[model samples]
Target: MTRVLALLLLLLALPLAACGNDDGEKETLTVFAAASLTTTFEQLEKQYEDDHPDVDVRLSFAGSSDLVAQITEGAEADVFASADDKNMAKLVEADLAAGDPAEFATNTLVIAVPPGNPAGVKTLADLARDDLQLVLCAPEVPCGNAARTVADGAGLTLEPVSEEQSVTDVLAKVESGEADAGLVYVTDVKGAGDKVEGIELPEAASAVNHYPLVVVEGSDHADLAQEWVDLVLGAEGQQVFADAGFGPPAS
Candidate 1:
């Protein structure tokens, strides 16, 4: 009859309406992170997605300095994770961060060489050699700042052939044999695996780098943003970072 047909149409419409409401219920969390954090954060993304099926996570990784610049320019991000304190301070200065940020992990500078060491470079002090070509991050970047600390600690002055915007670029130059030596984060070398070989430097003790994570202002999803921060500061997150060669944050 006509009444039976009307009931069937209403039942179909009810499911469609429920689906529309579910779309609005989705909480998307966006995080702007440092380039060195790429490998570790990938693991974090997977873990978080598995834990919160309804929440979606989007990540953008670059030089911490660049991320800060973008956030200051009013980019829409729910979280900001910096490779160092300097960039995190910038976010605070702009009032872009919600509150006092927390340090999640730490890293140190290392000398990265090509698989064959074509230039025969060695030692932190050897970086001052006139014949060696060096690629380093720009001084404004986190890796560059940490490199400066190691160089200063060793009383060695390095004249680099090129300054890259990100640590990944520095590692790429070394991996491709474009540069004889590169100063990059320890985590970068670990992530690169067979592409590059890393040499530990003792002076890095004086310049240990800290990674900080925070929720940015104007985020429509505050709870999810803070939850991501908690995840980063938690056991699984720390384990992933450590596996990538980063250390515990300084006390």
Candidate 2:
């Protein structure tokens, strides 16, 4: 009778263990995105988790080129969203993209200065002043490349004190008063709230960057990845982006 009781106890313990495992198991969907998407994506991440109880949404944000490098080096990522087509093309050229990338938003450059505009910056031409310390993204970065395009179109040359790898870093320099001004996206300046003042650049219209989204070629959660893509392309996601100051996707 003691042996029979032991067998029943073991069977009961097995079922409990199985139940525990089921409760703890979750599917993870990792998304690698541009640094500029941080705020908007974080909001979406929360919504996605609330709606999909069984799936965990993880986000990694960085410069588009850096994210591409990570993906190419075999970092496990389900999706990729770039701030520009140039960086997105890198993944396509490597054949690391699962399908044709879809344009999700557009962004244009703006001059970000400290509150009160102490430097009295008013236009892209003001960034070229020798006395002002300007910060800008590196040439390889989308923001930096766009800055160059805008500067060229305006017939001016920019001499930034530092070239950052990401637009956020450039914005940081301006916000901290470490630099008199910086070139960043319109969305970034808007998102900065009162921390920085935005000066519109007419030249910016010429270098508008179209943001793109795609699923990584070898993603284990391809269906989940596509779902995330669909969410971003859907009306809800666009509204979130619009609220954050992102422009509509290029036509």
Candidate 3:
């Protein structure tokens, strides 16, 4: 009787030990992404997690330049996605990126205004009005560069009240009525829906920014990082981006 009880206890403990091992050994893949990709990437994160139960997909979103700075400063991440080629090249040139960054999407700049258009901001030139408060992304940021291209192309010199570090920060100012107008990506205006209204800028065509994605060097989960990259380049990812108002990537 004693031997039988001992054997039963050992058998029960085996599966419990296995459960502990499985639970303790799960993998995590961290992806640093452009701020504009927040919503769509969140959707992709959920989908990837559902498909790969053993791996946790974590995301950190910020301005592309800022994200690159973080990585170059020794931040550990499995993947990097930039809102423009300039920032991606910084990583590639520094040997911090693992592979050729693939162009995933393109975006055009637009003028975002709070609900009701209180400032009556109708065109890019209107942003130059002395009384109208304007916010823009800092020149180092991708969106800011695009905004500058459009402004220069249209021969409109804009005097902004503030220059934010990220495009989302500019959008936030417009949405909260802190600024009368802001220059942001069309996708951001769409993402904000009724909170803000977008005024199309024709010169925006001349300053479209191409977004890129790549795996990071020295990542412990390079294979998983590549898988995430593939997923973003695949049909489902394209559809999600398209639905979010992102344009097709330029060749």
Candidate 4:
């Protein structure tokens, strides 16, 4: 009877021990970011995880406008990063931002075409050719907004074969040969390597998009979210952006 009672007590303690293990479970931090930031943010995610063993970083990438819509519609996110200030402004106006947004980087539009330049897209003006299949981001997206700005500044009108929701979608259309040319950010073109060739647009200077980041209001992990914001605005984070072909934040 004594041995049986001792065994029963051990079993009871085992369950308690198992319950205690849950205390070490990592906290999850969800981040919503613009599609243009995919590469850089992925790199940052890995670094952040390495440095913070107790936190799991989750990233959702999409067009800035789409991301704003998601956050405004009550999607739970700890952090938000926008490809342009206009979208970030919407978040602020909606009172979804926990803090003032910080400008982190800048990007400009470029024309991406398949290898060998099959359509001979040499300049922004060339995008106007009716015979060419041009893809661009929807005007509501940051990339699309910048494209329109540059085109209008040049006194030219663009007629795209498709208007995608994200910059990545525009690049994909060009990469898959679905479109002869697409207006994508310079970072996207650089990240594409030999899959596509980029044609520099002189007018792109007039439409540089400023990237911003902010902590979302009512985040369960508000402290962790602020830490992430600090990391991004810190020296190491800026280095990662620079290595990814992103321009420094405007003064």
Candidate 5:
């Protein structure tokens, strides 16, 4: 009967759709990382893919806070690499990170400006000016915390025009000329190339940010997750990160 045939076709279509979805899954390893890791991670992703043809590395880069929140909500990430120890420790506290995390690298904060320094900003104190539109990472994030420490050490109060969720966002504002000056990691300046210029500030010498990476606990793919972490911490991974301008890890 035609009616029976139609019902059978519909049921067949349902399994086909489900099959497609399952095929799409394809052994993915989800990595939650800080926005600043974009460039280096992309390179590592490619290298990793070439090495493991069957496994796909899926990355979601954002403010470490946001990523941590997602993981806490059970987003099912296999790995986490934060810009600072705070976020990594938060994962450890939540029993989200596997094993002991290690400090991978260090980065110094700098005052990033448009390529030409059109605002004529020259010093960290210049960020205090009411006329120069400045962007800074929110204090909840690692860069922001470093910014604050630098500001306090210099006895300066910076009222940024915008408190960005991530260092990359702050750099973006400067790159787009939306902001006259912004505080960002030295690695960001290196990554931005000519899009932005770095003006090293003495206050920046005050606080150093250390990055840490870890595999999450309860990962179904713990071995794969740790391989990714090992790549980031091992000589090859460390070389990639260091070449990108991150400092030697805390010994």
Candidate 6:
């Protein structure tokens, strides 16, 4: 009887261990993304978690150049999403990308000003006004590069008081009233909503930046990383990006 009871206890414990393995276990996927993708990626993270209960998606956002530097310096990232193709190309050139990077979306620069248009920034040319306290992304960043293109196309030479490392940083300066105006992505202006007013510039239309995504070459979670890439390129992910004001990826 004692041996039989012990055997029954062992059988019960086996089921409990199986339950733990099935329900309590999960894997984590680390993603490095551009600062401009913060809001949209956060939403997708939550959605992806809901769909894949056994996987956790962690996101780290910064300027695309900064992200590439981190990855090159041995950061353990499963995926990389760049705001522009230039940074993504850096990874590809280094053979750090697991596969061909796909263009997922496009964005354009817009002038973001404090609420109520306190600086009276009504146009792209207005960013040239010396009296306005302007902020911009540093030239190495995607938004900054796009801003430069827009400025050049419009024949405007801007003298911003501060050059931020990320587009989000530029938006923060405008939102906090530290700067009267900043050039950021149209998606960023939309994300900022009532915190800032967007000034549409026709010149910006000509300088759209393409966003790209790729799985890291050395990632241990290669299958999971590819799934993430598919998720972003799939219809659901495209809808989320579209709702955030991102344009369809170029053919």
Error of 1 at 241 (Å): 1.5
Question: lDDT values of the candidates?
Answer: 0.91, 0.93, 0.94, 0.94, 0.89, 0.92
- The predictions' CA RMSDs to the true structure, in order, are 1.8, 2.2, 1.6, 2.1, 4.6, 2.3
4 or 5, greater by TM-score: 4
Ranking by TM-score: 3, 4, 2, 1, 6, 5
Show model 6 residue runs off by greater than 4 Å: 1-24
Residue 183 in candidate 4, Cα distance off native in Å: 0.6
lDDT of 1 by residue, 45-141 (tens): 9999899988889999999999999989989999999999999999999988899999999888889999978777778988899999999999999
Q: Is candidate 4 or candidate 6 better by TM-score?
A: 4
What ordering of candidates by lDDT runs from best to worst?
4, 3, 2, 6, 1, 5
Point out where model 1 deviates above 4 Å.
1-22
What's the true lDDT of residue 96 in model 4?
94
Worst 10 residues of 5 by lDDT: 19-28
Candidate 3: worst-modelled 10 consecutive residues by lDDT: 147-156
Candidate 4 lDDT score at position 45: 93
Q: Return whichever of 1 and 4 wins on TM-score.
A: 4
lDDT, model 4 = 0.94
Candidate that would win on TM-score: 3
Candidate 5 runs further than 4 Å off: 1-25
lDDT of 4 by residue, 110-219 (tens): 89999989998898899999899999999999999999999999999999989999999999999999999999998999999999999999899999999999999999
lDDT of 3 by residue, 1-251 (tens): 99999999999999999999888888999999999999999999998989899998899999999999999999999999999999999999989989789998999999999999999989888998999999999999999999888898888898899998899899999989999999999999999999999999888999999999999999999999999999999999999999999999886
Query: Model 2's lDDT to the true fold?
Result: 0.93
lDDT of 5 by residue, 38-141 (tens): 99999999988788776899999999888898898899999998988888888889988788887888889988999889999998889999898999999999
| Model 1 weakest 10-residue run by lDDT | 116-125
